[model samples]
Target: MTPIGNLKPTIKIYDTTLRDGTQGEGVSLSADDKVKIALRLDKMGFHYIEGGWPGSNPKDMEFFDRIKKHQLKNAVITAFGSTCRPGVEPGQDANLKCLLDSGVKLATIFGKSWDFHVTKALNTTLEENLRMVEESVAFLKGNGLRVFFDAEHFFDGFKANEEYALAVLRAAVLGGAEAVILCDTNGGSMPFEIQQAVEQVAAELPGVELGIHAHNDSEMAVANSIMAVQAGVTQVQGTVNGLGERCGNANLCSIVPNLALKLGYTTIPRDNLSFLTELSRFVYEITNLNPVANQPFVGESAFAHKGGIHVSALMKEPGTYEHMDPASVGNVRRVLMSELSGLSNLLYKYKGLNLDKTSPEGRKVLEQLKKMEHKGYQFEAAEGSLELMLRKAMNGYREPFQLQSMRLILEVREQQPIHSEAVIKMRVGEEIVHTAAEGNGPVNALDNALRKALETIYPEVAALRLLDYKVRVLEEKAGTEAQVRVLIETGNGKETWGTVGVSTNIIEASWQALADSMAYGLLGEK
Candidate 1:
């Protein structure tokens, strides 16, 4: 059988999000969640998906058991665990035995490579640790499973005692380990250190398969992993969005694109490359975490252009500002509206919305946008509202709905079921709708009341949900009486859009944003 990543200089991607990503703060996945992620990773064409260590907990074991439903197309489902304990025979160790029992064809077992961990952490002699490594690899191989050995804390180990670390790798090599992974468990190693360590290992074992596992404590995990691959490693291990314990692990979202696109190494299929952004969002959705907007590859702001010069240059030649075409990775170039926006930026927006850029209307809209921005409206982050504004300024513009009035009541009373309620009056064409709803907050009550009034006329509004709300005081000198700007993010479980509003009252600001959010979605489809 051909070895995984056996093609000339092929770089195999090993995703450990199911295991390590769950360690991220506020991240918790059930057995079903783990299987769901493994299936998605398989769809992304990862070479290996390290599901989890079956022996660690019941959820991991259940993941191994349930992931079989997928019948994965491209990825090898790998079960992860540690080696047999000191003084325990491989077959007798429950953890080792559990890995084999999990019925996966590939297994990864992490073994201590640091002398300090061996003598102190495990309370065992160095020889016993080596014995544990060799015997565990040999035993797993004897069970007809391909095994990868993770040299835990290998970078620090190599720095502290190079000979012992080399011996550990040699032990795994002799024990029929298919690959030996050098891990920067502490995540503090620099790129140069990784380069030198990997160079020595590559020179010593020219034919052996090498991998790199890195953490992100010093924020060099992605850098160190790349350097290790450049030196000689063929396999890269990381969690999606860099989620892991503490500072997180190497960000696979960055590493894979660097290896496959920039460096010209085969990682995932060329066709699967575009799914990175969607895949990143998938993990974020399942984990219930807000994605870091500024993340390098799959972030919301990764390709967002805010500067006037940048928008101008990008409108002429995108490559002048962007490293690559955003569409190549399922991302799109975003021309943002801001105080920094130039005429070219407005022209870009005009073209995007099919407006006549040379017309007097375009000039008027652009001037209004700039003036409004100066008054605390940030269209860059609220394109939905910006688009609606542009559309309304056009010759054939049609208002989707007319707001009659809204009465917001906030009651602070003990033993009350709700704190706030809103009564909304709106007109759709000729029909007027009235509704009242209670909510946890005045903003929520307004949202509920507005939706209740609109949903019957525009059924699509039922799918919309308020995802996030953020407010900032625009006039800081006014203190509590300052004008507030509110940004409301809304989504329909499929796509998300942002809208903004500003007012002296917080509730009024929130209501404007919410009303604009619903109106924009309703009008855009028309």
Candidate 2:
């Protein structure tokens, strides 16, 4: 901590997704991905975007070169590396040279703060390590670059030998580093340890700027970060979706909101907070990883309500169940329909419709919903299908097309292939259209036949795309004789919707979901 007298209201966000995040297993990014993420983070008002360690790989060096062609508005592209090697001049160290060549004005470099690391890992004297830290910062500063020093393993090192860790930071300050960030390199420090250590640093280095770079090995990274902020650090270093080497770094998704909404700290332009959910999902998408559904603030299930009592309270006032408005974080509140759902969930889902819980029709729909749920139909994942059921029961809605009859044939040839075909009859308006189609599978053949029969009557049916299909076994013990539920997702180039069906027969379940998907898409009901 440089002796900065008072902590500022605004906490700088130092994002290291392109660097630390990519270190996580199964996480990799192209140079183009880095640029896209950097630009988005800048637009969202992050204070710093760590491009990557240019000394480590070609893709990172390529990122530095490519990002220079475009100007960023808010975020400063910072390059990351370690302090000069033991006994080497900072000017000649390849690591330091890469930082200079990265063409970024700001650089963050780490050095061993724990004496054990200096003695055991670096195999160098503690005094030489301090000199390395100081000279590395001085060399980068002399080259006209702002430097932030990461005192690696500061927490554990401080606990082990308090005097030496503080000495490490003092060396960085003497070398003209702008900020000193305490790193929980091993990700095993307790929050109390972090607070006590950070407070000690703030008091000792009164005018210094301090930051915390926490890891989530103990599932306390987010908690430790907030505690550090409260303990007087003015900057938070984290990765989106908590992506990092092992357990992960602190999740900026959770940290930003906890600081801004709860602690009243300013971060990333308060209004831009609504983009938090989108930003979290975007990073997961770019990394080709599935989004965590129950992740805090930005997850799909974060604000979702399912229990009847919870939904009842939430319907009257969202604050009863939600800590904060979902829209504030670019997430929406979901009133899920399940066996546990009450009339309140139904009423909330049917808010715009002319339906009331007291009505006989409404009671019928609720009973029907419960019965379906008991039989393995999950309306929560197939709200489109649920909506259709409610419309038919409560609003006397008629189907766009009725299934008359269907037949299928499978030909098992000698050595070529097993071919499947479907013949279907559908009543569209006053005419009955019969069609036949072949497909690689029975379900696909049924889909093709259904489309061929209805496309002429409703051209939009041809544009409907089956985005995803999933099947779940209701009872594993029943195995071959078990009832199954099929869920289908359909898109119309604009939006997507889900439909579900259940049956003992896989083909029948698939057809039911497929037909419902088509009907839901054709009706264009939200």
Which candidate's TM-score is highest?
A: 2
Cα lDDT tens digits for candidate 2, 1-526 = 0223334568999999999999999999999999999999999999999999999999999999999999899999999999999989998899999999999999999999999999999999999999999999999999999999999999999999999999999999999999999999889988998999999999999999999999999999999999999899999999999999999999999999888888778889888999999999999999999999999999999999999999989877889999988998899998898888888888888887777768777678788999988888999889889988887886557688899998999999999788999999999867899899999889999999999988878887878999999999999999899999999999989989999989999999999999899888877431
Candidate whose lDDT is highest: 2
Candidate 2: give the clashing pairs.
Answer: 2-207, 2-208, 2-209, 3-206, 3-207, 3-208, 4-207, 4-208
Task: Tally clashing residue pairs in candidate 1.
Answer: 0
Global lDDT scores for all candidate models: 0.89, 0.93
The lDDT of model 1 is 0.89
Where model 1 places Cα greater than 4 Å from the true spot, the runs are 1-8, 352-364, 391-470, 473-479, 489-496, 518-526
The positional error of residue 159 in candidate 1, measured at the CA in angstroms, is 1.2
lDDT of 1 by residue, 80-133 (tens): 999999999999999998999898999999999999999999999999999999
